[model samples]
Target: MENSKMLSPEQLYEKKIHVIGRITILMGIGLSLLVPILLWIYYGVFPPMDNLLKGVFTVSSFMIPLSIAEILSFYPILGSGGIYMAYTTGNIANLKLPSAAIGMEVADVKPSTKEGEIISTIAMSGSVIMCELILVVGVFLLGPISVKLNSPMLKPAFQHILPALFGSIGAYYILKDWKLSVIPMIIGILFSAFNVPTSVAVPICVLCSIYAAKFLYKRGRISL
Candidate 1:
């Protein structure tokens, strides 16, 4: 009790955030499994154990690597609360990442800082709410929306949406410190040219960027 009372505000906040984040993650897992479990029970449909294991192995082979890479790459930037919220709500790369990055940028807060964590969490929550609302509206207007989206005029734009979004975000940072960005950009381009898998490429890029940054900093070419 005395030690707990003596903890700093930051320590207390960290403890609280971890407890809440753990609970949220557990709930997310339960909810994800609940639907499949319910459907199986209701329909009395169950796959043979061998087939089920095969299917799981095939999917996990592709997904597990990517999942591990994404968690490692995004955790430092998103922090704990932001991570829990983003993963729980899904759409991390497209929505939550951009929202959190922009929020932190606008707030002039660096990642891993207290201010960054709060801003990131808030940005993630806002994105989740907006996503839910858009999904609800989309469900009601699915037919019209599908027709519009499928139109040739809009099809190209939809097809390239992810690239366009990331390009815009990348342009900002690349322009901000073109020197530090050069090595990573070249690495990414080469990896893409060779059709490297993203799961493998992401960690390679991260490591290359880190070494590049360190080398540049040692030479006084860029400030950390």
Candidate 2:
């Protein structure tokens, strides 16, 4: 208690974030399992242990590695509070990541800095709330929306949404530091040519970007 009182405001804030983050993570896990547990109890049915183990193994084979890679790649940008909220709410790559990036950009905050962390957390919270509200509204509108989305003329445009979204964001960063972007861009092109799965490509691209930045910084081609 005395030590905490002696700590700086930033230190106290970090301590609180960690404690609350852990509690929320545990609660999220419980909530995720609640529905399945309730259904199991009501039906008095359970899958065989072997079948469950096989299912777990199948998913874990790919998901564990992908999850580790995502954590490594995203942690620097998202920070503690932001990461907790983003992971809790889901849709990290498509929604939370873009929202955080745009938020920090608009606020002119560098990632990993105190300002960046606060902005990221706020952005993620907003994204989650907006997403939930959109989903609630979408439930009623889905039938009509799907019909329009599946129309032949609109189908082609819909197919480009992810590319358009990422491209706009990527263009800004690439322009900001073209030299640092070179090696990673080349690697990304190669991966795309090879039809690499995003789960596998993400970690590879992250590693390339790190090394490329280091090389450029050392050679006096780029600066922090």
Candidate 3:
């Protein structure tokens, strides 16, 4: 029973991390689905199986592909530990993703490295804590916040939140690595102008930019 003799501390932790992460994710999913079923049973009003299937299909149709695409895109940035924490807490795209990226950048840690992975996890964990605290505080403040939020002067700001956030964050990344930015920028702009979907444009630009940078690096056009 004492496998500790065969493994180093780091290896032991890594194994534990993988097992715990998978278990936590599965448990969270199970609980989420179970709640609705329990409510249906308690109410004795289960919907038709066909209707349930339709609902599942409707949600899955968008979510499944988007989830897969996001995992591929975000994996390099978030790494394994960050992925576990982010996925567990949810909000990977808007909250966890930006928090991790910005944290790594501020710490001068490049993504895909061990340092980057730890920093990403730390950043995302902090974000999750802050978000939970904010949610708690928000419940009491929502009444007043809603008034200001609904004010005419604030509508534009609210409407532009995502754009402002992404624009600023994206600009920072592009500026930080301007050479890497060129190809992706061009691809993103051209496809967007041509009415490509955001989802399609994002992944396409990512792949094109990565290959483009690699090609440039190999050709000695860009260093590092």
Candidate 4:
């Protein structure tokens, strides 16, 4: 009781956040695994156990590395609350992170500060709720939306939407640090020249970019 009374509000808040975040993440993962296992049990047709391990490894090889990189890149800016919410909500790079950044921009709070942390969490939570509501509406309007989306005139855009989206967003960062960006750009070009699979190329380039940045920063070439 004495120790508890002596703890600061910030300390108490962090403790609760840590406990809640762990539980939420654990439960979410458990439920995700449970769904597939339940389906297998219901069907009475579980594949060879070795196949399951192989499948998990094949997916995780890329996903785990990418997730690690993203977590490292964004966690400092997001802080604990935003990190918790964003991880649970999904779409960190395209949706949640952008929403949080725009909110901080409007609020005039800098990232990695206490005020920024609180506002980012609120903004991301709201974004998650808005996405869920939009999803519900989309489900009801699926037929008409599908018809319009499937139109031949729009097919090319739909097919290339990912590149279009990332290209637009990536253009900013590339221009912001064109010198540092050159290495990754060259790496990407080389990968393309060699006809590397996107899965292999993406993660390799991501890791290479990370190491390159670290090397530059350590050599006093750039500021954090």
lDDT of each: 0.87, 0.88, 0.83, 0.83
Q: Report RMSD for candidate 3.
A: 2.7
Per-structure clash totals for the candidates: 0, 0, 0, 0
Q: Candidates' TM-scores?
A: 0.86, 0.83, 0.82, 0.80
Winner of 2 and 4 under TM-score: 2
lDDT tens per residue, model 1, 1-224:
78779999989888888899899999989999998899899998788999999999988876888788788878877998888888888988878988898899889998878899899889888989999999999899997768777888887788888889888878877887899899998999999999998768887887888889999999999974
lDDT of 3 at 107: 100
lDDT of 1: 0.87
Which runs of model 4 end up more than 4 angstroms from their true locations? 172-186, 191-224
In terms of TM-score, which candidate is strongest?
A: 1
Error of 1 at 113 (Å): 1.5
Give the per-residue lDDT of model 3 (tens digit) for 141-182.
998779878999988888988988788878877776788888
Winner of 2 and 4 under lDDT = 2
Tell me, what's the RMSD of every candidate? 2.3, 2.7, 2.7, 3.2
- Residue range 115-146, candidate 4, lDDT tens digits: 89888888998999999999999899997789
- Cα deviation of 202 in candidate 2 (Å)? 2.8
Clashing pairs in 1: none
- Residue 77 Cα positional deviation in candidate 2, in Å, after optimal superposition: 1.6
